[model samples]
Target: MSTIDIIGLDGYENAYPRELSGGMRQRVGFARALAVEPEILCMDEPFSALDVLTAENLRSELLRLWQAGDVPTTAVLIVTHGIEEAVSLADRVVILGGDPGHVRTTLPINLPHPRNRKSALFQQITDLVYTILSEKDYEVSPDDIAVLNQGMYATFQPAPASDSFQQAASLSQRKPKSSRSEPFEAFETARPTNLDISEEWAPNQDSPLRYPQLPAVRIGSVTGLLSFIAEDDVDLYVLGQRLQLDVDDLYPLIEAANILGLIELNEGDARISAKGQRFVGASIDERKHMIRIAALSAPEARLVAQIYRLLSQAAKQELPEDLIFDTILLKHFSPLKARKQLDIAIEWGRYAELFGYEAPTGTLFLDRGDEPAE
Candidate 1:
C-alpha cells in the first residue's frame, strides 16, 4: 500500500472517490486491490483515464511491485487498447481476434527490462507485434510470407527447407556501410514474381471501379509508404512487421495506397505501382493534385459529394459529423465499420482539400480555402 505512493497523500486514507483527484483515486483503487493479497492481479486499462506522467509512474510502480513480489500477486494481466503499453509491460502478449474472440497469436517479449526505446532490438519487437495485429483474414501461404530472425533479415521461401538459410551478418558484409541497415537485402535472392494469392480475397486488380475498404491514411503517409514499397519489394506481413503497425493502423494505409493505384498487392507481397512512383517523385502540389483527382474517382469521395449536395440543396452548407455517422454510414454499415468509414471519409476530404472539418464543433463543410484542382 505504501509502495504505490498513496500513503503520503494528505488525508487520502479517508478521502472518498469524489474528494480525490482522478490519479489519486486510481492509486487508491490499486492499493485497495493489493490489500487483499490475491495470487493474480488483473487490471482493465487501469491508467487509461490518468494523465501521461501519472500513467508512466503507475506503470513503473506496478512493474516494480510485480518484479519485487512485495505483494501477494505473482502474475499480473493488463487489458489495454494501447499497443505500445502492451509491448512495454507484458512478457507474452496474446492477440485476440474480433467478434467471438479467440487467440490469434501469442508473441513473447524478449527485450530486456527497462527497455531502451532507441534500440533496434526493441523496435524489432514492437514492429513484430504490429505485424501480428495488422494481419488480414485472407488465406496466406506460409511460403509467401517472409520470415525474419530477431526482427532482421531472412530469405522468403514458398516452402520450408533446411538449405534455404542465409545469415544477416554475411549479407551485411556484402553491402556498402550505408545500406547495411536496410532489411530486405537478405531476401533479394529469394524474391519471386507475384506469388499466387487466391482470387476471392485479392482486390479487383482489373477493375478501376472497385475499391477495398481503406484505412484513414493521410496523403503524406500514403505517399511515403508507397515510396518505401517501391524501393523494397517486401511482403505485406513483412512490411507491417518492419513498420510496427497493427492491422488497425497498417491495413488502412495498404488499402488507401492500393485504391489510389499507388501500390500493387500480389499475393501477400506489396510493390509500388508506376503511378505511385510518379507521385513519389512529384512535388507536394503535384502529389496533392493527383490525390485530389484520385479521391474524386473513389466511392467514398462520391458519397461525400452526395452529402455535400444534399446539404447545399437544403440551404445548409454544413452538417454535423454525427449526422452522417448515424444516418448514412451507420445505415449502410455496422456500427464499428460505420465508424471506420466515417474516419476514412473525413481523412479523404481533408487530404484532397475537398472538405473541411471543424473538429471543435464536429462539423463538416466545403473547404472554400482548399481550391479544387485546376
Candidate 2:
C-alpha cells in the first residue's frame, strides 16, 4: 500500500527517513496509505504539520486527484481542529464540543465549488461558526473590550493621505513647466522653421489661454475624441455622459489643446488639426516622441497624443466599441486611475479624424485610395 504513486511521492522514495521533515513524512505516509487503493481514505489531522498556505495547496491537489478518478476511495473522512479547513475541504462538517470532545452538531456545506467569500450565506455560516467557538468557556476582561473598541474607532477614521499626496507629487514632477503656464509664450519663443501650410492658413486669436489640469484618463474621452473627429459635431452633454465624466473635467483639456493649435473647435464641433493629424498618423514609437514634444510646447496636445496611442493599442483587430471600454480601463489603469486619466485625456487630448462608410442603395461602389479612417 505504501509503494503506490499517491501524491506522486515515488520520486522522493530514496531519501533517508531522518532527512524528511514532519510535513514530508506525513505526505509520504498518506501516499503509502493510499497505495492499497482502499474503499475509504481516513486522515487524522493530515495537514497538522503544514502551514496554512501549503495545506490549502495540498488540499486542492488532493481534491483534483480525487476528481480525476485515480482514487478508489468511496468517501474521505478527515479530522481537523480548524473550522475553515473543514468548511473548505469537507462536504459535511462535524463540530465537536465539551472538554472530552463529543459531537455537538453536523453541518452540511451546500455551497458550490469556488464559494464566494463575500456571499451572504458564507458570512452567515462564518458568523455561526464563530459564535459556536466563542461559546466555549473563556474569560473576557475590560482591557480586551477597550482594545476592541479602539480598533472599531480606527476603522471610522479617514485613511492617511500618503497615497494621494504621493500621486499628486509624482504628477507635479512629470508635468512640464509650460503645462502650468501660457503655452503660446513657449510656442512663439521656439516657432518651428518648417511650419505646415495648414498652420499658416488658420486664424490667430488673442484670447487669454486657460490651462486646466486634467483629473485623469477616461473611456468616454476616447470615444468622444473619435466621434468629434469623425462626425465633426458632438453634444457636450452626451459626450460627457458617454465618457462617464462631468463637463468640468472634460472642457479644460479640450480648450487647452485648441489654444495650443493641436485641435480646432468651431461651430460647437471639435476636430484634430493638421499637426494633431500628423501626430496620430505616426507610428506608436513616433507618437510617443511627438507627445513629449507636444507636452513641452502644449501639454494638452501631449495628453491627446497619449489617448490616441491607448486607443490604437487597445483596438488591435477590431474597433473597441463602448462594450470593451471597461476592459481597456482595467488593462491600462485601475478603476480609480482610469477615471482620472480618461478625464484628463478628454479634457486635453486632441481629437482624431473620424470617417464614416455608407453603402449605395442599389448598386455596389468601390473606390481606390479612399481607405476609411478609424
Candidate number with greatest lDDT: 1
Candidate 1: stretches off by over 4 Å: 1-213, 246-248, 300-302, 308-316, 335-337
**Model 1 over residues 1-374: C-alpha lDDT tens digits?**
25333222322333345535565567677777877777888999997996443464446546644554556777888988777778767777877888888877767665444444445555666666676678746332343133223433322321111001111112112232333232322322331113221222233446665433446555445644652363346777876776677778778778877777677788877776655555543433445556655665544344544444434443456778887766566545678987777666665665555565666677777655545523
Give candidate 2 misplaced runs (Cα > 4 Å): 1-4, 99-101, 136-374
- What tens digits encode model 2's per-residue C-alpha lDDT throughout 5-65? 4453432333456534454466677777777878989999888776432353355446645
Q: Provide the global lDDT of candidate 1 against the true structure.
A: 0.54
Largest TM-score belongs to which candidate? Answer: 1
Candidate 2, backbone clash total = 20
What are the clashing pairs of model 1?
Answer: 133-247, 134-247, 143-158, 215-252
lDDT of all predictions: 0.54, 0.44
On the 0 to 100 scale, the lDDT of residue 135 in model 2 is 77
TM-score for all models, in order of appearance: 0.40, 0.34
Clashing pairs counted in every model: 4, 20
Query: How many pairs of residues collide in model 1?
Result: 4
